[model samples]
Target: KDTHDSLRDENVSIKKSYQDLSMTKASNSNVSSRAVVPEKPKVLAPGLYAMTPKYVPP
Candidate 1:
């Protein structure tokens, strides 16, 4: 009975720690999207349209 109780307690603690780890990962991703992600600008592929008249094929 004592072993079973101890095992259950350990299991609960491990589960709580795992939950915390996953939460931390989610928080990290949120922070990255909010801050670090914008630092690296997205390079949009060139389209057929141009912004100005001078944008012509060489």
Candidate 2:
């Protein structure tokens, strides 16, 4: 359950980031703005996450 919750949060974060990227891409004017794209979150080792919270429910 904890893993599932963590994954869900990560997925939501990625989705929101993608949405933001799309909005920025649409409104950006300069052709060189492609370099401004946000970097993706890095994946850590198994049972650990780079972005996910560490709280677990009993």
Candidate 3:
């Protein structure tokens, strides 16, 4: 039957993929995945300003 043939083909491909997954999974299971650690922002000091004379006569 056409339906049976397609089903068998799908099963064959599925089995192949399952085997690949199993092979790769063995190495991955030993070590965990790494993620970037969040860093805290540094605080900055404010700049100081000098006062100037408003009036000057020569």
On lDDT, the leading prediction is 2
lDDT of 1 by residue, 3-37 (tens): 99999999999999999999988766654342222
All candidates: TM-score: 0.51, 0.48, 0.49
| Better candidate by TM-score, 1 or 2 | 1
For model 3 the TM-score comes to 0.49
Write the residue-wise lDDT of candidate 2 on 11-54 in tens digits. 99999999999988766545443323125544476554454243
The global C-alpha lDDT for each of the candidates, from Candidate 1 onward, is 0.61, 0.62, 0.59
Q: How many backbone clashes does candidate 3 have?
A: 0
**Which candidate has the top score in TM-score?**
1
lDDT of 1 at 54: 27
Q: Which sequence of candidate numbers ranks them by TM-score, best first?
A: 1, 3, 2
